[model samples]
Target: MTPNPTNAPARLGVQLQPQHANYTQIRDAVLRMEDLGVDVVFNWDHFFPLSGDREGLHFEAWTMLGAWAEQTERVEFGTLVNCNSYRNADLQADMARTLDHISAKGGDTGRFIFGTGSGWFERDYDEYGYEFGTVGSRLDDLAEALPRVKARWAKLNPAPTRGIPIMIGGKGEQKTLRLVAEHADIWHSFVAPGDLQHKLDVLARWGEKVGRDVSGITISNELSRGSLDDGHADALYAAGVRLFTLGLSGPHYDDTPVRHWLAWRDRKNREAGVGAAA
Candidate 1:
């Protein structure tokens, strides 16, 4: 395993689930999250509702991403984990590149990160006419698709205005971690503290085998607090888990936790001696 970094710690983020929110609400929430000091803002890619009404007001991921690019100024943006099985690899790269351009309209192109995973949600594929294959087969497809995605980015007419970060999300050790080492600029997993540590160790081993520096890849996970004193946030942070994300539902988009998380983000940044944004 590669040695762990003892440098400055990780940062915080939020996953704004777009299923429950209308376009106006999501746009407002993105602006609010930026103002609240979120380092990254994410939206999951799924056609149907993950929670609430099964037929709730839903929005497509990439198109909403274009809107997010236009609306937010400072917050980094991307899908939490776009299913690779849904779209062709080259097309995915093109969409990401286009979003990169859209987000950086005023010279901030590095604001987009393409966070993707092997497809698991069958409903998305079934309704969309995508091939819903076995998990192993899907992983195989993702493995094959990633190289083509990168190569297509290189071959695009304008190319991406910046090197848009590639984030691979999953906890499958043999395939996913190896893929992270091979292709990801960031690695996202939902494992808890102890499990997350183990996976990081595994990822480091994969990194070494692939001759890649694992430290450059940011580690991210989801977060929620029932109360302000919850120890979950601190524990994850201490474990070298930056990019903490809180999921938000809509129609009633409560800003309470969002406010608290921003406060936490500022405190962490201060402890690391990074100047708080004014």
Candidate 2:
């Protein structure tokens, strides 16, 4: 884990929920987001939409990531949180490496973030022929898979275009935090600002036990799902969050919400004396 100090530069990420929109609409949205200067763009790893119609129009995550690699120029793109249950760890490593190369503008410098999590949505498993294990077992699987992922990256032919940042999402104090302390370059969680301090405290303990300085791990928080304005981003920053993400659902993905968050992000970045483009 790359232990970044608590004062890491503020950044913004946008998650493009792959549901209800056709490929053209999704593609256009992604391009528009890049133009708006989000530091990262993401899509989730799931076979179906998480809300509003379980059987809604949805696209696979990694394949679309591959598309994002070809589509955008500057913004880093990735899975908001890939479920590790679907494929072998080594294969994922190879895919990440490939995407890294594809996103690289100058020969080999990819902008791919490997954000992943243990499988949670059970329907993705039942329908896809994966063994739907209990939560603990799934976490165990994630813990086991990540090292293999790194190892595979090391052994890949051309290697990744650059060091891929591993962003692990979850707030499980016992296993997830420990994994973040051990493996994550970015720690993503849904904990609101009021609850963030305690999670950070736990993460620090995990860091101490793991003998890793998690201060370098970039903190990521999600924007409130229902609102358009900034809710706790500033508070989260005060509590050490540097990456604020907002996810948009589709069919008709209004750019209004994203633009609002972008405005908030710009203000925060200006205050921090950092360019929002990075």
Q: What lDDT does the true structure give each of the candidates?
A: 0.82, 0.87
Q: Report model 1's TM-score to 2 decimal places.
A: 0.93
Error of 2 at 91 (Å): 0.4
Per-residue lDDT over 1-278 for candidate 1, one digit per residue giving the tens place of the 0 to 100 score: 44235354556667788877778888888888888777788988999888889899888888889889888888889998898988989999999988888788566565898999997888888888988989899999999999999999999988898888888888998999999999887788778877777888899999999998887787777775445644887887778776777778776567798788777877776787756632
TM-score of every candidate relative to the true structure: 0.93, 0.95
Best by TM-score: 2
Clashes of each: 0, 4
Residue 23 alpha-carbon offset, candidate 2, angstroms: 0.7
Residues 88-171, candidate 2, lDDT per residue (tens digit)?
Answer: 999999999999998998664889999999989988999999999899999999999999999999999998877799999999
> Which pairs clash in model 1?
none
